[model samples]
Target: MTAVGAPQERAELAPLVTEPERPAPARRSPRRRGRMASWLLYAALAAVTVAFVYPFVWLVSASFKPRSEVFDNKLIPDTFTLDNYVQVWHEAPMALWLLNTVIVTVLATAAVTVSSAMVAWGFSYFRFRGRGPLFGLVLATMMLPGAVTMIPTYLIWNSLGQVGTLTPLWAQNLFGSAFYIFLLRQFFLGLPRELFEAARMDGANQWQVFTRIALPLTRPALVVTALFEFQAAWTDLMRPLIYLRDSSTFTIPRGLKAMLDQFGFGGEWHWEIVVTASVIATVPMIVLFFLGQRHFVEGIATTGSKG
Candidate 1:
């Protein structure tokens, strides 16, 4: 009987040992697999990052390289120089173009920010007849391509005697933009109503509540919207081309094109200067984007939160 009991005990011990060993193997397998997957995900992200970064790297590198070396596809040049920048400065009215762009972008962005915020505040806080329809109209305008209205817009500006002037370029923002209005409206809607109510109880009017409480809380959205407007104004080629007939009034894009035209296709082609101009044109927008990146992301994230 003792021997039989010993055998049964050994059998139970064996089962327990085998069960622990099985879990150990399974756990090891999953851990190894998880590590492999993690590595793969990181690798993929690195690849994507490189893919996006490569173009800007090439553009910057090309700006410093000679025309003959631009198409070499090399990651780094054996020789880099600032001759392109010097030539671009001397040849084109780059400084003037940059100044014009800055003026238009700053004014337009300011107009859009203030007007859009006001409209958004009204739409969100005020109860009025046709409010929903008005907001719908704003959204609907976004669906209409700019190309569709370009000719008509040009004609209207021309009739208003604003053609061939910077007024036409910046005047469009006087009425604000549909997209920006919608964006700001959505952002305004996300604010806590209690804050506004409390402000009202404290003798704060609507304008005071907006200027103090709403604007402060919506800084991220405002910054992002202003940045977007700035970029659009800076990079705009068509509006400037259509409205600006004077070289002195040209924006960077228009100035770049004019430079290309002046150089032509023959021996006069200054690829270095053109490349440098392109780089300079891109720098301000890049700086603005990096500076406002955090706010931009936050604004987009919160824009639709309450809507």
Candidate 2:
């Protein structure tokens, strides 16, 4: 009787089998977490865009404001005037300056693109003796400061009787650049040797191969190079400052500097006109960027990448 009673007691004391507690429902679903992160990322990008773009917006608005209100930190001015634009036309030889800038920039940009591409082609495709050494020399050129070479170059151009004109500004591009050549060479190396071999097998000369095959296929890199050259030429002030003797031949930057010296140095500082001139000078660059943004982005993205 005692043994049977003990067995019954043991059975009663054993705990009931309990289902494991389901983990408390997740605070948020995976889909919800992903959506939250995506939203946060977009918000960050939007903020950065506004930060970069706000200054230009302010500049545009300030260009229309009165001189007294230029620094007011207000997007909308109390008074808007076209007097600034009117002044921009008459205050200096802006039209002449624009023409000079266009001529110099266009010529220099073309020279740089053509010369750099040719040099790059030689370095990439040719295997002559001293080719490696010559490339090394080209790279070494990049280390020499332009300022150090400026006086010597100017004297050389002066000796040639070309110092006072725009030729000195653009003529140097005929020699090509180490940086651009290196950039294009890498792209050329990535190109399939088979295409060039196939073209040569068909009796296409080097010139024909470069023009018909290489250039056409390397449009993205070429466009990028041209755009960079264009911007460099456009924004150059020092070259014009050194070489341009006549106000009539001054590039836009040099003319703008002259304007600042004439107007901003004294009692009657015409800030509005200065601002207006800046807007005129900057519009072309903005337009160019918008037009070639696709190509610009591609060139940067795939510059050194294999096909």
User: What's the residue-level lDDT of 121 in candidate 2?
Assistant: 96
CA lDDT of every candidate: 0.83, 0.84
lDDT, candidate 2, at 44 = 100
Q: Clashing residue pairs, candidate 1? A: none
lDDT of 1 by residue, 94-204 (tens): 899899898998899999999989988989988999998988888899899989999999999999998877888887797888888888887788889999999999999
**lDDT leader:** 2
Q: Which pairs in model 2 have colliding backbones?
A: none
- Model 1 alpha-carbon miss at residue 5, Å: 50
Task: State the local distance difference test value for candidate 1.
Answer: 0.83
